[model samples]
Target: MKKIVSVAVSAALALSLAACSSKEKASSDKESSKDPVTISFASWTLGTEKEQNLERLMIKAFEEKNPDIKVKIDESISTSDWNGTLSAAASGGKMPDVFALPQIPLALSNNWLMDITKMTEKDKDFAKISKAVRDSATYNGKVYAVPYAQHFLGYFVNKDLFNDANLDYPEYGPSLQEFTDAVKKVTNINKGIAGLNNPFSISDWYPAAANKDMGWYTYKDGQYSLDSKEFIKGVNLAKEFATNGYTYETLTDEQKANFKGENPEEVWLQGGVAVKWDGTWAAPQDASFDWDFIGIPGGRTVVTNDFVGISKSSKHPEEAYKFAKWMSFGKEGFMKRMKIADEKGKMMNTLPVSTDKDVLDEFFSIQDVPGIRTAYDNLDNAIVEPVKIIPGYVDARFEGQTGVKAGDNENATVGQLMDSFVKGDLKVEDYAKQLDQMADQKTKEAMDSLNK
Candidate 1:
């Protein structure tokens, strides 16, 4: 659930990919032929105390397991600053041996990644992963990424808040109308608790609504159906929540800042928001006021998680490959990392990506039991966020979404558009029209580029 947009693009929401410059190729020389091979890794998580600690433990286990490779860590202090750091690293010939992906196509095109198809074939852990997930990260028959974690947005209920309001518990996959009805029951913004926040990010309700109305993005003849009745219906429902002050759209800037932190789980500690619309990462437990998460009522699951790729500039490709395999799918290393997560009660932040029944069974056993059960139920019919969505047309109407392209500005971004629509500055019908026009043009452009 991280923003994947280009850093050059405004820091909107996630959707971008890029690669290292030629400078990367010049640094293939080894430190010394006699010295133990060293592989450097980079992580956005290197900034957080909890994540950095977890990473150190994982690396420690990996080192102990191999006993031959020494790891160097280059961390980005903030995910917001990650784009600049990554671009600078590639341009400066300092790309790490293993790093998580912010963008996909650019990395694959510029040879920023190593093809790990052979490794996946031989690794039993990969065999446990889903084909859809593996294929989503593939380009030209090569496996460039190993998706390590994935998640979707859902309704996290503060049971006490709901019970106090006399609202019934949400069904696992409630329909848009059903969730809306539930929100109405609990939302009393005058009292200081929002009925809900954005489903995943600011204005993410559009996609969540689309997911609820249709099991996938509305595409007709290869064009996104932004103006479709279902889309309009979804947007209207979100607007209804805003109008009644049942949603985070009603929150003040300071309130928003508190909930938008790196560790937003702290919001639960206060215990006033009855129904918080957030992703899997934010709802990993029930300790804060007897809470639990459920999939978007009647919505198709959308997974956008972290991925690891090996840098082409690596002098030790095999060692880098070994590290990538160990982190993502190697049974011993992966489980050790999972055990650390369990010990520290950080399963939500460090969920496993493997689809292997045995590994997952073991993973579920150690992590949040109730949360994992809900997750398993939700992922049964999940779909990864398609590249053709936000990533496909950052230059067109989605500009503010991926950040400002040369001709784009904030007023026209997906986030801004939704904000206006929700605030009544723009009409839902008009917003739908704007989206439809962009969808048609971008869809054609995407097709043309693909054919080329």
Candidate 2:
């Protein structure tokens, strides 16, 4: 009986211990489940303390909405070295969960971007984004990045200068002829004020301006149309303005020396130039005189976008996608960002990519810059800037892509050829065909290498 009792007691004690272990495991798991998953985010735009603080607020707002996730901001990356840093991180299998993309083609080619096509397709809010922005993020029929902000390149007109020249302020959508005429009328070499600061930007603006169907840098249908008549027109137009005394570039050395400002480079700020070819972000806030922004000479404008993408190496891809969306085109996030900006009495530098009515209303309410709203209202007709989107553009443009003879050399890059053409050493009609072929071939080579 004693042995029996001892055995029974031992068995009961063992069962009790097992039950306690089970209970402890259940409790531990419950506690662990409450721990939030952490993800990392990086951006070159957040270099300044104020910008980082704003990003922190954005992160805070995001955390409030997503208590189950935590974000870690990586501030070590900067614009100059982001590509190299990302390349190293990717090779090490330690890329940040989400980060800004400087070049979509580079990210895509290196497999740094997580495929977000399904997420984007199912996202109702994403569907509300502008087509131009959506197209910019898509590559090879797949979405890789989300547009964070868009900066429109347009004319910043000094209204006072226009008045001084006795010319009416050009409207939102001025024709090329009208633009040319305004430049002529506003020019007064005697007063040391040129009509347009420089016509160099016309090279960037004219392709789309001349033909709304063409993309910036003469990109269209996955090919470059550098030889298109529209491109030739734009190049010739730039030459016309540059050679004439209408532009600051063509001003005589004596004229520059006699300019009103101590710094002739500051002519635009001194209200000496009538129409300054610049981006929407360049709109001055504390100008001594009135100014307004308008679209490029043609109906279309060049819109450059900043993008954010999730890393392919991310462990928490879904979570990273959520954060990326929040940082980019998510309507709710934009509303929160606007609220934060308003509370801080700060102005947003770039426009929201969201096309949702509520988001636009919120953005316009806080954006008080003159003529900016009008310019943004016409974003439907805007063209995407090519350098950010086109693969190998930097190489094909700056570095020599073809061995074709150009400008007293056996090989020349498109930039070199353009330099020769603009300086009147080469004719566009003679070299447009070769430029088109070279640009297309270089782009194809880049794409082929990426595929391999």
Candidate 3:
């Protein structure tokens, strides 16, 4: 009887052990079958409700396609907070899997982003990207990110105002005189309208021509060129807008009161102003009003592409990279994004920077808005804004430095501001010397980082 009981207990123990092993195998297989993990994305912002919803939808679509991965996007950051946010994340080793990267050589050289040059070369679609956009992202010999869309610097004209003033719609590239004359024809203050206007205000002029505000960044040689002849002319034109009463200026208390509605796109839409120089992003947002646009005169029409980059600290680098490529390179993915913008009927001012000839031609062919056609027509002369081309160039030299208000007198001379900055009169260098120094600093900073 004792032998029988012992044998029975041993048999039961063996059965239990076998069951446990089978269950463990099943669990391991399930774990292996599951997709890897999540990634984080950060960008400058998504200001409007429509934009926020569009972003969420796009993210959802991406996740749906990439079921194995999840993306957590943080869009609640102001421009002031962006640098600190990225820096803190980097220091903590908890940076987003992908983030909006700085577009210039200096910020990129800091080594916070994954090198995307190889990816661009390896991917066939890389050939389809805009050269200017790619060049802006390239540091040394490598490209670090893919730019998504083109944001052009152009003038939005109220067609009705132009007609009322017996003026033609602005040409692709008008002369400076032509621009001024056109503005004068359209000015009608009693009707609460101006000839032309932007929020550039007194101190806002210098940066408008050279800073991130205008997208005119570039570097060459060892110095920067914010005070270049071309740049100076640009600022001079801005000042002209003030001096000629084409822009908002406060000569007296009453004038200051009139300058209150500087950004009233509605006013511009309703023909309150003859023109407003804004990004392509403005067109879609002003659907209720009919409008047209022309490229700024004499200067190369500039555009800034929104750059998409991967974070070096991401846990799921491969997936993050794949997602960036999908968003930036895949036809289906990008088209879906464009479709979303089209659906909202907001500013479809963004154009594709893809190397695809079909995409480019189609982009031009689809004239959903008058501004779209005008921009497309002006493409041959298009150049990315100087600020977009050169990173950090805007902040270092142009920010609040040398516009109409730089001299502090409302009636201060534009030439004095230019001479002061270009000549380094405030103690930087002679005007010619200042330009050379800026170009050199920018070039060295960009190339050195890339080589590293």
RMSD of each: 16.4, 5.9, 9.0
Global lDDT of each candidate? 0.63, 0.79, 0.59
For lDDT, the strongest prediction is 2
RMSD of 1: 16.4
Order candidates by lDDT, high to low: 2, 1, 3
Ranking by TM-score: 2, 1, 3
Tell me the spans in candidate 3 whose CA falls farther than 4 Å from its real position.
Answer: 1-32, 46-52, 74-80, 102-106, 190-192, 198-234, 249-266, 284-289, 340-349, 355-367, 374-381, 388-392, 399-452
lDDT of 2 by residue, 273-374 (tens): 788887777777777988777778765756788888898888998999888778778888888888887898666756877778788777777666646676
Candidate 2 clash pair list? none
As a TM-score, model 3 comes out at: 0.72
lDDT of 3 at 94: 75
Worst 10 residues of 3 by lDDT: 199-208
Compared with the true structure, what per-residue lDDT tens digits does model 1 show for residues 1-452?
A: 23544453653322322223333444444333446779998876555545457667778778887777998887641367765677788788888888877766546545577777887778777766665567667765767787766666566777787787777867566666677777777766555566675432323334544553333345432556667777666666667766656666465665555343333345444765667766677653545477776656554555666787888788888898888777765666667777777787654355567766667778777654464465555564565555422335343333534232212344457656655666656676855766677766765665455435
**lDDT, residue 398, candidate 3:** 48
